[model samples]
Target: MDHRGGQVEGGTPDGESLPALLRSWRRRTNPRGIPGLATPGRRAEGLTQRDVARLTGVSERWYGALERGIEAEYSADFLDRLSSALQLSPAERRALYLKAVGRLPTLVLPPEAGMPEDVDEGLLQRFLDNQVPAPAFATDLAWNVIGHNEPLLEWFPWVTRQENQMRWVFLEPEAHEQLVNWEQDWARPFLGQLRYERARHPKNEALMRLERDILASSPAAREMWNRREVVEHSHGALRRLRLQCRRGQEVAVRIVALRPMRSDLLRVIVLMEDQRECGGA
Candidate 1:
């Protein structure tokens, strides 16, 4: 029984209950690792509810109530504090938010974010190559073009030279002439996606560096970045491009962004001709 004479839920191996999981996590944390935490005269192993409450800036009773899965709607900030106090992993933090708030947190990126899984390089290259006439390329989380088909390299040779798609789009002078309606069709949306990715992986060094380079080098990029627009992806979006293959004629392409099951962090982008527009012409 707790101090309130209520029965404390003991965790099971399955640990489906919120209270049980919280208690289990609390017990697993090492007291010695936590800086300035007092361990003397402690009855239970790991951190006590009082310790967690103090760390999270809440009363012991309130923290206890949260652990008990009380039906109060917890704010995102409170849950964030609680997650930090418990030293929850990304997956664990997501689980805590889902259990407490009936949804995922806005800022919680999965553990796989920015980290690409190992895959057969030959197979991945073959997959891009199979796209044939369409421009197909694969990018890591930081928009670094890791792999591209012949068509992609032919159409946007800058990818081979620049390595990073974001850098080429935001910083390259040639991009303005190549991308039709550079400001509206490309820059704005691309900036939005970049902002979204940066928000997701705030600690990513390459992304931060790219952001600094673009904002510092290009006044247009600096202006667009400050617009505060955010986009997750450009999938199914119709984008126009002025390709040298077409003698500088503008062509409309439909963006198809796919995440391979084996490597969720690798984005496979294929620019397929917009059949609806093509058929109309």
Candidate 2:
């Protein structure tokens, strides 16, 4: 579906380029972020080529060659080790493997070309106004909370902090504690959305930093990243959120999303009462 200023030509989105995707991944996975042993003279927090080699029990020269995007023979064992050493989420690991072997999806931009800023703002406002009974907000392509109505902002104070959604989902302790089922309710889908974005715009520097921060802050996010699951945000998906409200009562709400007309931005996320389900007191 023409999400993100790109078209779906020949069964794929326009501007779907593999090199771009690889560059994006590289930007995100810094030397210190990967989990493994470290020694003196290491200048960065992200894993170095040597570190990856150590973790995978391979030579540093070979790993360096791989990182340079040079053509080389790689076994499944080598790929698995590299994936682990890099702490690549399942989606990331797969994308790396595909790109390394010259197998990646082709992106196609829509015939209309691109989405305008005004259109994004208009659609977001419309959704917030129309879905008054529910809490709603619009997030940018990078999952940064860009705008939201009063109700949503009230419940999620972090939204006001301008924190990236993925960071809050995985790094923030409060967020983790408040979410009903952190893994199923948030992490899984959140990572999926990140994967989709990465696939589309792999070279986005902001996106890369967000991923790095999440990895450094939360081991849970790191573990999940290694899983490499590719997922797209599904419309109409609902999740129950239990929050301690201002009225001193625990409230249970269902979260739903309203996507914009021509952008990847999720214009609004409505949180409403679940009359049939009982959890909050």
Candidates in order have lDDT scores of 0.77, 0.59
Best by lDDT: 1
Backbone clashes for every candidate come to: 0, 27
Look at candidate 2 and tell me the lDDT of residue 172.
Answer: 75
Q: How close is every model to the real structure, measured as TM-score?
A: 0.58, 0.53
Q: Stretches of candidate 1 above 4 Å error?
A: 1-115, 279-281
TM-score of 1: 0.58
TM-score of 2: 0.53
**Model 2, runs deviating above 4 Å:** 1-116, 120-123, 246-253, 265-267, 279-281
Among all windows of 10 consecutive residues in model 1, the one with the lowest summed lDDT is 1-10
